[model samples]
Target: MMGRTVLVTGGSSGIGRAVAARFAADGADVVITGRRVDTVAPAAEALGVRGLACDATSPGQVAALAGELGGSLDVLVNAAGGLPAAPAAGTPPLEALAQEWLSSVSGNVLTAVLTTTAVRDRLAPGGAVISVGSIGAERRGGSYGAAKAALAAWNVSLAAALGPQDVTCNVISSGYVAGTGFFGDGMTEERHRALVEETLLKRPGTPDDIAQTILFLASPGARHITGQTIHVNGGAFTTR
Candidate 1:
């Protein structure tokens, strides 16, 4: 990856940060983005990579980020997404529900779609576009899960479109990865244990676990793989 240019959205922390770190370690020209400058700057400086503040869900911001790239991108990791904030208090229940659902889809699905669209032309042939998906999409994930499921559905179309150009697109559907602040402080001991127990590995999934998988997808070895939702859930969710 010495000559590669990789862009990781939401790379200031968690799995995105780990992915950026891995690419930097391998000598890729890495650029990371966060919604806030304060977080993006320090993270980029600490990782010895370029940092930009871009809201992945905003078309204008994402377009500007593409312009700043200046060169073709080799790998794009769409890791900018999370659970939406709760709706304001005193709002009507129906309105609050609508707000939460919309926010969930925007943060998770639109973030990936808008960013990828903005940089689609900047991707060189053979470049890879990888997005972080979730097992929640498979079960009782509610609106957030529905958004992730939509992301995977969208990836299939993207892969078909980009396949002719020799660019690859895929989703990494992870299960219960720790250290991502995914559940915030809501993860109780019993809940954590239950999640791990569901996995065949009987252990927690780490950021490195997902990052290593993303690295492989971006590598030459995974060149033939595209339009697929590869599960990295320690067997917590089985396909067959």
Candidate 2:
């Protein structure tokens, strides 16, 4: 990865932070972006990489980020998303449901769409575009799941279009990963145990687990693996 330029959105924490650190460890010129400057700046400094503040879901911000990059990128990791927030109190039931659904779609699907489109021309040939998906897309994923499923669907067409350019695109559907605030402050002990029990490994996944897969997809060995959603759920869900 040395001398290669890697861009990771939402790299201020969680899976994104891990991915950025992994690439930086391999000597890649890594640049991480988050919506907040204060958070992203510290994370970038800690990882010893450059940091940019950009709200990926916004076209204007994404365009600004692309402009900052000077139209050159070797790898793009779209890890800028998470579970949707709960509906606000005093909101009507129907409106609350709608808000939750829209939040999920915007955070998970729109973020990737806007960012990838903004940087499409900047993507170097033979580069990789890796998006973070979720196992929720498989079972009772609700709005978050639906959004992630859409992400995979979009990646297929994206792969087809970019394949001719020697670029690869794929999605990584992650399972119940630990070490991040993904579950926020609502993760109960029983729920945590249940999640771990569901996995064959009987343990929750770490950010490094997902980061390692992203690294492989970016490597030369994975050139032929495009337009696929690779599940890293420790046997919680299997694709036939």
The reply for model 2, stretches above 4 Å from the true place, is: none
TM-score of each: 0.98, 0.98
lDDT tens per residue, model 2, 78-113: 999998878879999999999999999999999999
lDDT of 1: 0.93
In model 2, the clashing pairs are none
- lDDT score, candidate 2: 0.95
Task: List clash counts for every candidate, in order.
Answer: 0, 0
True-vs-predicted CA distance for residue 34, candidate 2, Å:
0.8
Model 2 TM-score relative to the real fold: 0.98
Query: lDDT of all predictions, in order shown?
Result: 0.93, 0.95
Could you give candidate 1's per-residue lDDT for residues 1-240 as a string of tens digits?
Answer: 678999999999999999999999988999999999999999999999999999887889988888888879999999989897788889999999999899999999999999888888889998999999999999999999999999999999999998998999999999998887778889999999999999999998899999999999999999999999999999999999
